[model samples]
Target: MKRKEKFENRKTVRKTECRRSRNLGSCPAAEVSKLQKTVNSFAYTLEKAHFLDYVQYASNEKRIFRRAFLTGLLRGFGTAVGVTVLGAVIIYLFQALAKSNLPYIADFISDIIDIIEKTRK
Candidate 1:
């Protein structure tokens, strides 16, 4: 049998067994109590996790947009500063290499530095 069919058959069998065992004909109250307990547990979990606070925050469009804008602005500024520092470090390394005894590498780095200087003019 299909998986879903098997699951449904088992569920039906359990319901019948439960009714027989409890001697409850319709078992409406028992089902309602079970549902209520499940709902209460879910609500308690949500409350404990502060889900309502997050929902309230998300419901405010202006606050969400403002937070997003500030986050993006900080990220962009951080990226710019990081890149500048990294570039400076790389140039310093190149300068050190230019001062070293390796003639070919020194010449190549010097040429690159000259090109960069020319670009600023």
Candidate 2:
């Protein structure tokens, strides 16, 4: 019993020593530290992979598809609103410029308007 207990204690100590050497840097400190960092990075990567797996398993494909569809729909709506606002601002700017008493500017505006009308026809 004593011999068996001694062997078991030594085995446990060896396991702990290995872990301690990895974590607390007993020897080959720099290399061990790099390895520990890499192991920690892998741990994080594994956690992320698990999280993604859970997300995939818990959510149906229809849910994911709806999420993607809504995202695209919102994006398209934003683009349309942005273009409308931009066109309104441009028209307001041109109208403001037309109101100014600059003869050359008025002629330029009339020429632009004529070109637009020609395009419409």
Candidate 3:
């Protein structure tokens, strides 16, 4: 019975020592510090990548906006010029038609004047 009790106590001591050693072996101070630094740097790198992507997206948007603005400006200018030319042409044709009918209008007026004179006499 004495030997069995002694053997049991020795086994308990060995188990405690093994547990402590295992806990110490899992994470040393140097490795724990290195892991913390790695985690921080990983987070920083992701932030940088996101910032760069945002910059690129903004640049592309700016370029597209400028192109749209320029295109709208040119189209507006062209429309203005085309409308002005079309208005001028319509006015010129109306004036030409009036001039061409003037001679007929004058002859009708002269015939009316002659008839009135003959009727008075």
Candidate 4:
């Protein structure tokens, strides 16, 4: 058989199995109670998690903009501080190396340090 016919046969088999497994006409009250319990559980979960408040906050344009601006500002400030600290540590290491016994490497590191200091000045 073709792929479409095989898929339709499988679907029909699944439907037959489902119908045989559940006699819904004879269990209306049980079905309604089960459905009500599921709905209540879902609502209780949403309320506990404050899902509505998050939705409201997400829907407000001004709050979103303010949050984004603060996030960017903090990220930029953090990056600047981190780069400054890293540069200072690297320069300190270079200065230490400049005082070592390796003459050629010391000279190169000292040149770099001097250039950096000049740029700062």
For each of the candidates, give the backbone clash count.
0, 0, 0, 0
The lDDT per prediction is 0.88, 0.78, 0.73, 0.88
- Top-lDDT structure, candidate number: 1
The 10 consecutive residues of candidate 4 with the worst lDDT sum are 23-32
lDDT of candidate 2 over 36-76, digit per residue (tens): 89999998998978977877766798887888899999999
- What's the true lDDT of residue 29 in model 2? 61
Candidate 3 residue-wise lDDT, 1-121, digit = tens: 6999999998778656655675645555665577679999998998978977767768898787998999999999999999999966855555565456577764565555556558779
What TM-score quantifies how close candidate 4 is to the native fold? Answer: 0.68
Model 1 lDDT vs. the true structure?
A: 0.88
Error of 3 at 113 (Å): 28
Pairs of residues at least 3 apart in sequence or in different chains that clash in candidate 1: none
Candidate 1 versus truth, CA RMSD in Å, comes to: 7.2
Better candidate number, 1 or 3, judged by lDDT: 1
Candidate structures ordered by lDDT, highest first: 1, 4, 2, 3
TM-scores of all predicted structures: 0.68, 0.51, 0.36, 0.68
Question: Cα lDDT of model 3 overall?
Answer: 0.73
The model with the greater lDDT, 3 or 4, is: 4
- Which is the better candidate, 1 or 4, if ranked by lDDT? 1
